[model samples]
Target: MKQNPTPAPIKINGSNIDLGEALPRKIQDELAHVAETYFGHLNHATVGFTRDGNWYCCTINVQVSNLKVIIAESSATDCHKAFDQSLAKVGRQLLRRKQRVADSRRVQMSAAALA
Candidate 1:
């Protein structure tokens, strides 16, 4: 039987900045979608925002499994924009990581078998 895939949990933290009430929910939804698309299921994700002068720096950390963790970061004038940029980076990283993991687990045919 096939089982339904659940989105990974996400935690958001902002340092010296107000994330607004709805932005957090929106961010969570978007992050969950991205995580689900690439990893099927992940342990969890953490997003941190910090204001550096005029730019907002956003950092995203995704725990793909017990041993693998992916991190991405971006800086922009707006926190949302920074997050969007970082999320894009995360998606790319996740795809590459998935490919590597899949390749590593694939069984290779012995030379004798091909002969």
Candidate 2:
């Protein structure tokens, strides 16, 4: 008898490549946890945190099973707020995209029936 293969665990990779003080280690761990818990069975994740003077920016690229998701950078004078807002933006985009894919499928099926 052949054994079934289990799905691979998601991969999360983050770096404070430019601004260490702007993003604390605790926040980095939290970001990884949130992504694993909520991001549509993500296959891979890449995150970068940076700062411009007092402003902090967080950027994340999340890959799901079937889509490539790019989130715009989110910035604020407060580091925690900037990080939270960036993740929230990604969540909102996922919701909107889910609706769009469903709508497109409906249209395609309707057009096919008319043929």
Q: Could you say which candidate leads in lDDT? A: 1
Query: Model 2, range 1-115, lDDT digits (tens) per residue?
Result: 4322443243333344443454555454554555445543555555666777788777767665477665646988766677678778777776677778888999999999999
What's model 2's TM-score? 0.62
Poorest 10 consecutive residues by lDDT, candidate 2: 3-12
Model 2, residue 79: displacement in angstroms? 2.6
Q: In angstroms, give how far residue 76 of model 2 lies from its true place.
A: 1.4
What would the per-residue lDDT of candidate 1 be over residues 2-90, giving only the tens digit for each residue? 43566567889999899998879888888877877876666888999999999999999988655478899999999989999999999
Task: Supply candidate 2's per-residue lDDT for 45.
Answer: 58
How well does candidate 1 match the true structure in TM-score terms?
A: 0.83
How displaced is residue 40 in candidate 2, in Å?
Answer: 3.3
Candidate 2 wrong stretches, greater than 4 Å = 1-39, 111-115
Deviating ranges (above 4 Å) for candidate 1: 1-7, 107-115
Cα lDDT for residue 87, model 1? Answer: 93
Cα-based TM-score, every candidate: 0.83, 0.62
